[model samples]
Target: MHSFSIILLPLLSLLPSTISQTSGTFNAMTFNVAGLPAILNDNGVPGDKTANTARIGQLFTQYNISLIQVQEDFNYHATLYANDKHPYRTATSGGVPFGSGLNTLSNYEFTDFARVKWNTCSNIDSADCLTPKGFTFMRVKFAEGVSIDAYNLHADAGTTAADTTARASNLRQVSDYITAHSINNSVLVFGDSNSRYTRTGDIPSIFSTANGMKDAWLELVRGGVAPQAGTDALLCDNPSPNTTCETVDKMWYRGSSAVELQAQKFQYAGNMFLQENGDVLSDHDPVLVDFAWTKV
Candidate 1:
């Protein structure tokens, strides 16, 4: 019922391709569901969170998203869970005011599921302290003997000094955890990282500088070039399908000694999540990244 099961995937996918022992593919996504209670919902964001969340969950199966990380998955989580068919999903950590608002859904099996709270908090430009904001981690298996450490997080949001300090600590916490627990293991980190490389005072480089992970959007979409110095300049106000645009929703990945991983595509998924009235489902559009793996 609440997130513990052993659903088997296709036998063919479970085994590496015999023709090319290394060739395999999978896709991962991160979306902020904006599942705040009606009273907390941003008036600017149309449609009902409860209604949209169900559809959001349904879309994953429709798209065959291999794995998903959802942030702001607070209130209305049941509806999201009810509609999503993914056999591997994280149990909600209660709703906002009590939860960290982070969760993951996967088609493949995973283990070592864990949650970690940020060591610091602030409510300068945003109300980060109103809930137990933090990150979640797990080891997802792509196939037999093939597993990668995966993570989901919602960091402190704001631009004030207090906000930057807290966000810095948040990234450091994730980086530290990867260094300690996932060293030499393949890693796939995704979620709403509020911090932006273009924004001043953001430690967005910690993923690469500390964990040796590469940003999918930066490397595959931007040709490995960072955004020009600016204040998160490309934050889209509406659902945008352009993957080159800068955003807080991010994905970082790295391969291990036995398997090599490369980003095949980075997509900003939008059209599939729109409501009848053409309004987007959530405040943040999902980041979907396709990956190809081969034995090293």
Candidate 2:
């Protein structure tokens, strides 16, 4: 009996960590709260920018989202933070003309936080380049001894050739950063990408083909088939997510050799973010992804 037990001990070490002990799931959201000053943001989207951002803060706790990454948090920084309740969060850089307009709120502790401004931007939009405008990278301690890199960004916006070129540069910059800094690390990249699968010149394959990251929307909601790269109608008037319809807000994730991260659910969660009058809190939808993790 002792001889049989000895042989079994080594074999058990080859198995994955006990699922009940170490595996779990979490929900992460990416939202671009239209937070420009009232005059500048007026007529762009429905609802008061101030009121919408303030309420946007409250929904985080109400929905019990495990973590969040927000963009366009420029003018209404204080208004939104006043109502938010995340114990772990990044301080606002400041208002635009000075701030990058990016922030993160998480249930998990994170470290090595850093921000990088885009090397390029197109003046076609004018407003997109008003801020530092780029992405933030950090190492989030997801669970005891389980760490994953998380990134939040607001890329260049517009549809002109110059705009698309700048946006492509933005995408590649993030991809290069991941390649250099997060090699072989589990990572989650989300925010207002402003790049769509069906949009020409938006180069969405950098994440999948270059970094091996999986798009939550494509994997969970679109049956793993990426929409063909070309221009298509984007119908985002409703809260219900359509298989064919993709939004600018995107979430990309990848698991390392030690930990396997898989997204079980991906959704356009705008219903809970609407004002009492039914106007949306922001022009872009708040995308939520539920991820499950286990040792590989």
Candidate 3:
């Protein structure tokens, strides 16, 4: 089990609130749990891949995560992957051959859920187009009749140029849709973005642009003098460990609510199989964040 702690500081200029009352603070996590399709046959370790499903469930239960976003999935097959104790509703996109998919799980009763497919390319050089993938958007009602949007996204990955195009286009489609039909101003986007801020690309652009939205991690680092998660919570450091780096997985938020980010973390313990004698859990580590929403 991995543990994370966060220290919050007051913002000099507080942003305006959009909700009447925050009601309560909640935690959200994004993890690409290496799709546990029914057909996968684990070579060994911890009673094969099938046996590890329970451990996955236990992790979720331990975190008390209100919302979860994951990538790489097979609709019917993946449904059986989760334990019965934490039943959830999921939405899948993308096409066969390419495993790009999205999965969202929420503990709260979801008022509405749907998948929004954008666009993608199978190969940047090749003319073949790939299918886009995304997850369900839960309309969470806050105080003052305000609402927040929760979602997930998995963009096509590859070289900088290729990945950039796919991330931007797909993000634009989703952002446009949300801005059009969202019940409230607040929106939380999370999942495998596949592009980083230092890297030249659109994944960060689509979210950080003046159009609306801000990366939750970047927001946390704002005006903070302490060593925070943003500087240390690099999820995929196992493949090539270097003074803690950043990668695709990310979280974003929208709306004019003075949000005081309480905590943000990366969970990489028993799951950091590379360092744990190959007890491989998933390719990407989970990112979690806690926030306090102020109501207008």
Best candidate, TM-score-wise?
A: 1
Residues 103-168, candidate 2: write the lDDT tens digits.
998888899999999999988965677889999999988776788999998999999998999999
Error of 1 at 284 (Å): 0.3
The TM-score of candidate 3 is 0.69
Poorest 10 consecutive residues by lDDT, candidate 3: 1-10
lDDT against the true structure, each candidate: 0.86, 0.86, 0.57
TM-score of 1: 0.91
Extract clashing residue pairs from model 2.
Answer: none
In candidate 2 the C-alpha lDDT for residue 249 amounts to 90
List, residue by residue over 86-195, the lDDT tens digit for candidate 3. Answer: 45645444334453456666665556777766555546643224434544567765444545777777765665576568667777776777767663467888887766
Please write out the lDDT profile of model 1 over residues 215-262, one tens digit for every residue: 998898788888865655677655775766788889999998987889
lDDT of 3: 0.57
After superposition, the stretches of candidate 2 with alpha carbons farther than 4 Å from their true spots are: 1-21, 238-243
